[model samples]
Target: MKRPGIMIKDVFKRLTMKPVTSKYPAEKSPAEPGYRGKMEFYVDKCISCGMCAKDCPSFACVMEEIDGKKRPVFYLDKCMFCAQCEESCPKDAIKMTTEYELAHLAGNPQIVK
Candidate 1:
């Protein structure tokens, strides 16, 4: 192991570098490729296969029977933002969007068809 002076030098070097923090809300940050932020569902394209709910690792996805068709209900509070549901959808109905601003006052469930 190196001396403690080496660690101090590393810290000083980082301090001299430009800050990497983003000004969120005031300025939007670009998401990296394949970054999973939010989930969106295309209702008409969905076949009600229930694959998305079954494949969700966080148990955030649920298939509900609404009206005459089965719809997907996503609990964002319980989601890990893994985008597993998007990959499991056979009909290409589910998608992971770049929308990461999911803060809500009432915290309601997202009903996607």
Candidate 2:
């Protein structure tokens, strides 16, 4: 009973203490070891390979044409965040990073051509 009250007061005081904030958007914080952030497309490394698209269980990924060039367009809305795309990439062009803050105005990943 007494410890709970003391603990409550300590927590309140700590909340107003020195601020521990990370510079988001400008500076990214350290993600966990297995963090899954937005998937990055290293087209240079990619050999126009369709392994990631074919292996995706959800079929959420799409390879589209971009100015006569074929590129991968991933639909985040349909994605399951299973990291299958990353694993399927032989060139390691795609990876899952720990970036939980993936907010977009469109609500869809318009990476396709």
The lDDT for every candidate, in the order shown, is 0.82, 0.76
Residue lDDT tens for model 1, 1-113: 75567688779989999988878869888788777888887888988899988998988899898888987888888899888888888889988888777787774655444
Report the lDDT tens digits of candidate 2 across residue range 10-103: 7999988987886776987777787776677777787777888898888888788777777677887677789898898889988776766756
* Clashing residue pairs in candidate 2 (N, C-alpha, C atoms within 3 angstroms): 35-97, 35-98, 36-97, 36-98, 37-97
Give the Å shift of residue 108 in candidate 1.
Answer: 3.8
Candidate 2, which segments miss by more than 4 Å at Cα? 1-31, 106-113
Q: Estimate each model's TM-score.
A: 0.74, 0.63
Highest-scoring model, lDDT: 1
